[model samples]
Target: MSLLVTLAASTEELAPLLMPPLAFAGIAAAIFIALGFVVFSFRDVANRQGQGAGKSSDTHGSGH
Candidate 1:
């Protein structure tokens, strides 16, 4: 009887460890979606160099 009770208690305790797979999968899917967004938004555009202080292409000293 004691062994049966201990087995039943152990089984009951282990029930939770078997659950939460779907929760983990959902979190994984969200992380994957965020990573996809970052990978898709990355681009390399030429002729887009930064213009620092006192740099201009127009006439007059308008860049100062």
Candidate 2:
């Protein structure tokens, strides 16, 4: 019982957060959104290479 009381008291005396808990979540959300934009920017890249870009006389059989 005494050990439990001591542990609770120690936990209550710990240092405060540098930022609010919500701020940490917001920072993580912003980073994910930025990365999402980066991935979105690469959309349809294969189609932009023009027709017949992958075809060649040396290749054979469905290309795969």
lDDT of the candidates, in the order given: 0.66, 0.80
Candidate maximizing lDDT: 2
Per-residue lDDT, model 2, residue 54, is: 59
TM-score of each: 0.41, 0.60
Instruction: Provide the clash count, candidate 2.
Output: 0
Against the true structure, whose TM-score is highest? 2
lDDT of 1 by residue, 1-64 (tens): 9999887778444355544889889889999999998876664322244443224554455653
